[model samples]
Target chain A: GAGVSQSPSNKVTEKGKDVELRCDPISGHTALYWYRQRLGQGLEFLIYFQGNSAPDKSGLPSDRFSAERTGESVSTLTIQRTQQEDSAVYLCASSLVTRDIQYFGAGTRLSVL
Target chain B: AQSVAQPEDQVNVAEGNPLTVKCTYSVSGNPYLFWYVQYPNRGLQFLLKYITGDNLVKGSYGFEAEFNKSQTSFHLKKPSALVSDSALYFCAVRDADSGTYKYIFGTGTRLKVLA
Candidate 1:
């Protein structure tokens, strides 16, 4: 793809429902990252995946938040039993390699009602 | 742990005036700093980065940032502010010594350029 792409630009889900956000990174980018941004707040790192090594999941806020990337292509971030506090913009970014500049997607705005 | 701080929540500047958005960082050893700008309803756009060499690094849209190791700051600057330059700016830092690829971002500062 020409640039990083995210699906379901906006999502409205009821509390306790599960929601999945998808990210299609730029072609050939081996590094993928997920972030969350609440209104009037800075971006919070959620997870990072680099080339098939063990993903750095330290940023995941809670056990209900999980993510997976298959073969450096598409990635999905899933929030189980979403809480109202989980309403925020979920962003995805990709880079050619670690420590390189990252390209970001438009992000999916999730609203837990 | 690496962290970035953007002390100002908002900065208002008149068009054609020089503008600056302050940023400071904390990290072990040297720091890899970055600046990104975000427009309404849009993804973040990379503005610039400082890795090594010169202390001043230039980036897209006539924007530049200076890396000060002693002060632990990477302030973004522009000679002239444009009305279109109004957006949210973010500063980020990564630990150079730890080899950790993750970047810690600062709370964003909103820039408003009045025409």
Candidate 2:
């Protein structure tokens, strides 16, 4: 795709359930980022991947949150034992390189019931 | 640590009038500033960025932002507003010299342009 794409535009799951959100970054983009935007709040950075380097996971809220990306293409964010506080729009973005302008996806809105 | 502050929770402007959304940021070194807009039920759309050279940066949808280093601020602006311009605005910053390559964003400001 020409732009970043995310799957399951909306997702609803019960608390304590596991959910997976997928992202397909712009072709050839080397930097990928994941962010969570809670209702009425700003974006909270979750993770960053720059090519084959070790991902920067400092912003991840908890151990239950994890992400994996394969060869600068598809990435998946997994939330285990989701909590009410975990509800938010999960946004995915990709850039041509680290520190460059980022292009964002439509985002996957997750609702934890 | 880097951070952004959007002073106003909301700003109301009439169509055809000039609009300004305030944003301030704090960073250790030179800052790479950016502005993004979010429409209802949509993700962020990049508007403009201030890296170096020009303090006034132009972006998509006829939007622009001025970076003030002394003030530590990057305020988004538009010459004339439109009803369609109503949306949420966010300001972000990253330390260009920090080497960490992380961007910190503000809480966001909602802009309502009435026709």
Candidate 3:
């Protein structure tokens, strides 16, 4: 695809259940980023992957949040023991290189009950 | 570390009026500034960026931003506001000389264009 792609667009899970969100970055892009947006809040940087280098995971809010990206293609964000505060629109973006123009996906809207 | 602040929570303007969304930044060395817009239920769409040279940078949808070095601010502006322009606006900044290569974003400002 010409743009970043993310799925499942909407996910609903129980408070203690775990959920995984997927992102397929633009082909040939070397940098990918994940962000979380709670309702009425700004985007909170979660994690970033640059090629094969160690991802910058400083933004991960908690130990339960983790992400992995293979090469520069597909990436997945896993949330363990989901809490109410964990519910948000999980957005994925990709850039040609780090700190370059980034294009964002439609985002996955996660709802924790 | 890099950070941005959007002072206004919301700005209301009538269609055809000029509009401005304020943004300020704190970073070391030279900074790269960017603006993005988000419609309801959608992800952010990049509008413009200021890397170097010109302080005034033009972007998509007839939007522009002025990067002020002394004030450490990059405010988005439009000559005329349209009903369709209503959306959430964000300002982001990254230190040009830093090795982290991270973009820090502001809380966001909601723009409401009235018809």
Candidate 4:
């Protein structure tokens, strides 16, 4: 793809339901990142992947949030038993390297009712 | 811990006037600074970054930022504000010596250019 791509531009789920958000990074990008942006707030880092390995998972808000990447391509963020606080925009970004400038996706707006 | 701060929640400027969005940072080592802009219903767009070399870095859409080591600041500046330039601006920083790729972002500053 020309740029980072995220699926399901918008989502509305019940408070106890599970939701999956997907991201397809630009071709050949080795570094991928996930972030959360609450309404009227800046981005909060969630996780980072170098290839298929996630070196940092310290930013995940809780045990209910988890993510995985496959072969350095598409990645999925899964939230189990979602809560009302989970309502936010989930963003994905990709970079050629860890220190390079990142290109971001439009993001998935998740609304947990 | 590395962190960034954007003090102003919002800044209003008249069109064609100079505008600035302030940012300050704290890190254990030398910093790599970045500025990004977010328009409504869209993702963030990279404006500029200050990794090294010259302190004055020019970026897309006539945006520029200056990295001041002494002041621990990287303020975004535009000589002439445009109505289209109204958006949310964010400042981010990474600690070069922290050995981690995580970037700390400040709360965004909203810029509103009045015509």
Candidate 5:
């Protein structure tokens, strides 16, 4: 892809519903990151992947939040039994390398009601 | 652990006037600092970064930031503010000691330029 792409630009579901957000990073990008941004808040780091391995999962808010990446090409974030607090914009970013600047996707706006 | 702080929630400036958005960080070792801007309904755009170089760093949109090692501060500046410059600004710091490649971000400062 030309840039980092996220699917389902907006999502609205009842509380406790499971939701999945997808990310397609730029081709050849070795590093991918996931973040959450609540209304009027800062970027919250969720996870990071170097190839298919996730070196950091410290930012996951709870056990219900999990993510996976395959061969550095695509990644998915899943939220099980979502709550209203889970409402936020899920952002994905890809970088040429770990230390390089990143390109971000428009993000998936998830609204848990 | 790496952390960033943006003390102000909002900054208002008049057109053509100088503007500054303050940021500070805390890290165990060397800090890789960065500035980013976000327009309404748009994703963040990288502005500039402080990797191992001079204290002063210049970036897009005529913006510049000064890295003060002693104070652990990276303050963004612009000599002449424009209405178009109004946006949400974020400060981030990469953890120098970790392989997680994680960046700790500040809460963001909304810059409003009055015409």
Candidate 6:
């Protein structure tokens, strides 16, 4: 795809269940990012992957939150034992390693009941 | 720690009037500032960025931002606001000289243009 692609435009899951959100970054981009936007709030950084370097997981909220990306392709964000507070739009973005601007996906809206 | 702040939760502007959305930041090193717009139920679209050199940076949709080093601010401006220009605006900042590449974003400002 020409732009970053995210799967499951909307997801509804019960509290305590697990969920996985996927993102397909633009081809040849070496940087990928994940963020969470709760209702009426700004984006909160989650994780960052740059090339073959170790992903910076400093922004992840908890141990239950984890992400994996293989060789700059598809990435998945997993949330275990979801809580109501976890309900938010999960956003994915990709950019060239040297570029400061990021192109974002439409985002996956996760609703935790 | 690096952070960004948008003082106004919402800004209302009349159609064809000049509009400004305020943003400020605190970073440990040189700052790379950017503005993004989010329409209803859509992803963020990059509007502009201030990386280096020019303080007044032009962006998409006829928008621009001025970077002030002394004040540590980057305010988005449009010469004339259109009804369709109304959307949620975000300001983000990253420490350019730092090894970490994560960007910190402001809470966001909702712009409403009345015709």
Name the top DockQ candidate: 1
Q: Model 1 over residues A1-113: C-alpha lDDT tens digits?
A: 38999999999999999999999999999999999999899999999998889999999999999999999899999999999999999999999865479899999999999
How much is the lDDT of residue B29 in candidate 4?
Answer: 96
Candidate 5 lDDT by residue in tens digits, A30-66: 9989999999999999998887564589899999999
Docking class of 4: high
What CA RMSD would you report for each candidate? Answer: 1.0, 1.2, 1.2, 1.2, 1.1, 0.8
* Residue-wise C-alpha lDDT for candidate 3, range A1-113, written one tens digit per residue: 57899999999999999999999999999999999988888988999998889999999999999999989899999999999999899999999864489899999999999
TM-score of chain A of 1: 0.97
Worst 10 residues of 1 chain A by lDDT: A94-103
Q: Which ten contiguous residues of candidate 2 chain B have the minimum total lDDT?
A: B96-105
lDDT of 5 by residue, B58-102 (tens): 999999999999999999999999999999999999866665568
Alpha carbon deviation, residue A52, candidate 6 (Å): 0.6
Model 6: per-residue Cα lDDT at residue A94: 95
Docking class of 5: high
Task: DockQ each candidate and list the results.
Answer: 0.90, 0.79, 0.76, 0.81, 0.86, 0.89
Q: Which stretches of candidate 6 lie over 4 Å from their true place?
A: none
Q: In angstroms, how far off is B90's CA in candidate 3?
A: 0.8
Each model's lDDT comes to: 0.94, 0.92, 0.92, 0.92, 0.92, 0.96
Q: What's the TM for model 5?
A: 0.97
lDDT of 5: 0.92
Candidate 2: stretches off by over 4 Å: none
Query: Per model, how much of the real contact set is kept?
Result: 0.90, 0.81, 0.68, 0.77, 0.81, 0.94
Chain A only: TM-score per candidate: 0.97, 0.97, 0.96, 0.95, 0.95, 0.98
Interface RMSD for all numbered candidates: 0.7, 1.0, 1.0, 0.9, 0.7, 0.8
- Candidate 3 residues lying further than 4 Å off, grouped into runs, are none
